[model samples]
Target chain A: SAVISQKPSRDICQRGTSLTIQCQVDSQVTMMFWYRQQPGQSLTLIATANQGSEATYESGFVIDKFPISRPNLTFSTLTVSNMSPEDSSIYLCSVAGTSRVSNEQFFGPGTRLTVL
Target chain B: QQQVKQSPQSLIVQKGGISIINCAYENTAFDYFPWYQQFPGKGPALLIAIRPDVSEKKEGRFTISFNKSAKQFSLHIMDSQPGDSATYFCAASTGLGANNLFFGTGTRLTVIP
Candidate 1:
């Protein structure tokens, strides 16, 4: 298991503002992912942050709206640009273990963003 | 299409009783299945996991039963306790290295003392 932490545990942002959430892991990891959890909903994969490469995003999400950067193995960031009330959700980061068979993931304490 | 489906959005189990949560997946490529537990104001934590090769895996009081032919799996918690009350999520992943998890809707389990 890995120790993961996210900055700005929470924040309240205006509708037009932007906020970047930072995720840091104690040890180096192979894969890092960003997720969004709406109120009373399941977790949605926002993107997969690749070290030294552009993040791979899933459908219903885009790079222009949710830009991501992963400079190294243990660090990544997700920036929600031009936020809106509908953008209010808990943003979480996770790191996948190196094991090929198991490959479990450890998550960071999410960043709760309340867009008003 | 929804990749993963979960049942019993909420559950109430008496202490020391059995707590069961079921999940099914549509993608046969998904080889990894994991159960995550989340408390209020925190991120989800990996509780237990299973691979396709195994029919069942037990860790202490928690057990995961996998039926590969049915494309389904379930989590069984023996001797439930109040501390076990939390939102449980079942997730599946293909060859994406477990980074891209297709999470189920989640089950809110309330174990009463």
Candidate 2:
């Protein structure tokens, strides 16, 4: 199992300001992902953090708003730009399991962002 | 399109009773089904997972019942306790690993003593 940690357990930011959340893993991983959990909602995949290239974003998410950078296998950062009230949510980073059959993903203790 | 569909937006179960949450997927390409448990102010943790090759997988009090033909799966929590109260999410993904997941809406469970 992979151990994951996120910076800033909670943050209150002003609207229009950007907040970057960092994620660190215990070891090298192949797949890293960013997700957002809104109030009383499910987890929505933001993008797949590729090690050397641009992230693969989901349908509704875009790079300009939620930029992601995976400099290496164990570290990645997500920046929430031009924040608004709607962007106030928990941002989490996850890593997929090494075993193919196990196919599990471990999530970091998300960063709760509250936009004021 | 919603790839995964989950039922019972919320559940209330008595202590020592069974709490069941169901999910169905429309994409046949999905092979990995995992259930995650999330407490307030915390990220979701993988509770139990099962592949399509197995019909059922259990870990302690948590069991994952998968029906490949029906494209559905359910999580069963037996002998529910107050500590089990939290939001549960069902997710699916393709391939072995390295793929993004499609998550269900999630179910809030309250286990009353």
Candidate 3:
């Protein structure tokens, strides 16, 4: 399985501020996805961070709110811009491939964000 | 709309008993169904998965039973243990451009000794 790590394992941000979360994988991957897990809620797909193109946001998510950058195949970042109280959630980064024990995707530990 | 519905918001099972979690999907385009296990302060890990081509798939103590015609699938955990207590999620995804998985609400499983 790929070894994935995220910076700022946990953070407390004030409303109207922006916090960027970085995801780094030990090896190159073809697909990297960002997900959000709200308090006591299921995991929600935020966007698909493409290596060279604009990130593809989900239906209820917008690029302005969650901008993503994937400079290389092994690294990506998600910036929660203009954060709000409702934006408090655990943000996770995942990679898709066959390198893992399972055919499914492998995820990072996750970045815990709490907006006050 | 692609939505995977899961059942049993919470469950309590005794150790050495069987724990079952069911999930249903409305979209037939979903060809891949995967179950994930998540512990507190951790990301969800892929537990097991099954495809439409097979009716059931088993991995050690965990099994995934799929009903293609019914668009429903269930996870069975045998010989449940205290260490198996965690929140489980069922997700479905299509083989479209990108693998965008739609997840269910999740079921909190508590295995008591």
Candidate 4:
């Protein structure tokens, strides 16, 4: 299991503003992912942040809206660009387990964003 | 396409009762099925998981029942407690590709005293 932490645990931003959430893991991880959970809704994968490479966005999500950066194996960031009221949600970062012994992925505390 | 679907948008169970949340997936390629529990103002934690090869898996008070033929799975919480009240999600992944997971709509469970 990995210990993941995110900065700015909660924030309130105005519409049209952008917020960048940072995720840092205690140790190097093979996989890092970003997910969004809308109000009262399930989580949706925003992208897969590969170390030293461009993040892969999921369908219905584009880089323009959610730009990601994974500069190293233990850290990544997701910036919600041109934010809107609908974009207010909880953003979480997760890392895949190192070995196949357990496919369990550990998650960060999450950043709660509220756009007004 | 949304590969996974979950039922019971919300559930209310008395203390010491049983709470069950169901989910179904369309992609047969999904080899790993996991359930996550999230408390208020907190990120989700991996609760329990099962593979297609097994029908059921248990850990503590949580249990997962997998049905390969129906392409469905469920999480059963035994001896529900007030602390167990939280949002639960079911997710599936192929474990081969990029390891991206498809999540089902969450089920909010309220364990009443």
Candidate 5:
């Protein structure tokens, strides 16, 4: 298993403001993904951060609203642009194939965002 | 369309009892099914997973039973404890690493002493 950490554990931002959440893994990883968990809801995949390439945004999500950057292995960032009250949710980062205990993805602590 | 479906939004099980959560999928292409546990203020943690080729997989007190023909699976938590109280989610993906996973609504399990 790998140790993953996210910056700004919790934050409150006003509408129209943007916040970039950073995810850093203790070791190099091949694939990194961003997910969102709405209040009292299950997680939803936001995008896949690819190294040296444009992130793959999932259906119902666009790059204009959520932009991702993966400069290299072990690190990635997701910026929630034009934040709105509906954007308030827990943003999580997960990595795959990094000492996977049982071929499962390891997740970060997640950044709790509250858009006011 | 909802790729995966989970049952029993909430459950209450007594200590030392069996806790079962069921999940069904609509896509047969999904070969990987993983169960995640989430605390109140934390990210979902991968608990256990099973592949379609296997009928069951067990690790410690957690077990995953898969029925490929029926397109269904379930998680069985034995010897439940209060510490097991958390939101559990069932997710499925066709591929690993870079593939996106479809998640269920989640089940809140409360193990009472």
Candidate 6:
């Protein structure tokens, strides 16, 4: 299992402002992912943060709105730019376990952003 | 298109009873299915998972039943307790190239005493 941590456990930001969430893992990981959980909703994959190259984003998401940076194997950051009421959600970072036998993904505590 | 579909957005079960949540996937390429449990103010944690090669896998009181032909799976919690109450999510992944996962909406479970 991988131990994951996130910064800014909870933040209240003004509309139109941007917030950058950080994720760090205890061990080197091959893949890091960013996810969003809206109020009363399930987890939505935001993007896959690649170590050396650009992140792979899912549909309905883009790099312009949610920029991701992965400088190394153990660290990555996701920025929610030009925030709005719709952007107020819990952002989480996750890492798949290193063991090839297990595909389990461990998640961080999550950064809860409230846009006012 | 939603790759995974879950049923019973919310469930209420009595203590000592069984709580079951079901999910179905549209993609035949999905080879790995996992269920996650999430509590308020917390990120999801993997509860149990099953590969298409297996029909079922059990861990303690939690069991995952997978039907490859039906493209469906379900989570069964035996002897439900109040502490078991939380939101559960079903997700699928191809486990190939990138291994990006597609998650379902979620099921809120309440175990009443």
Off by over 4 Å in 3: A98-103, B96-98
Per-prediction TM-score = 0.97, 0.96, 0.96, 0.95, 0.97, 0.96
Q: List the residue pairs that clash in candidate 2.
A: none
Local accuracy of candidate 6 as per-residue lDDT tens digits, B1-113: 77899988999999999999999998998988989999999989889888999999999999999998999999999999999999999999986543777899999999999
TM value for model 6: 0.96
TM-score, prediction 4: 0.95
lDDT of 5 by residue, A1-116 (tens): 78999999999999999999999999999889999999998889999999999999998999999999999998999999999999999999999877543347878999999999
Candidate 2 lDDT over residue span B1-113, tens digit each: 77899989999999999999999999999988999999998899989888899999999999999998889999999999999999999999898565787899999999999
User: What is the Cα-based TM-score of model 2?
Assistant: 0.96
DockQ of each model vs. true complex: 0.69, 0.75, 0.59, 0.63, 0.62, 0.64
lDDT of 2 by residue, A1-116 (tens): 78889998889999999999999999888889999989999888999899999999999999999999999989999999999999999999999754455467889999999999
Candidate 3: residue pairs that collide? none
Over 4 Å off, model 5: A100-103, B96-98
- Ten consecutive residues with minimal summed lDDT in candidate 2 chain B? B93-102
Candidate 3 residue A79 Cα shift, in angstroms, is 0.2
Distance from true location, Cα of A115 in model 6, Å: 0.9
RMSD to native, candidate 1: 1.2
| Candidates by DockQ, descending order | 2, 1, 6, 4, 5, 3
Question: What does candidate 5 score on TM?
Answer: 0.97
Higher-DockQ candidate of 3 and 4: 4
lDDT against the true structure, per candidate, is 0.93, 0.92, 0.92, 0.90, 0.92, 0.91
Error of 6 at A36 (Å): 1.0
lDDT of 4 by residue, B28-93 (tens): 999999899999999999888888999999999999999999999999999999999999999998
Measured with C-alpha atoms, the lDDT of residue A40 in candidate 1 is 90
TM-score of chain B of each: 0.97, 0.98, 0.96, 0.96, 0.97, 0.96
Tell me model 2's lDDT, rounded to 2 decimals. 0.92
Clash pairs, candidate 5, are none
Write out the backbone clash pairs for model 4.
none
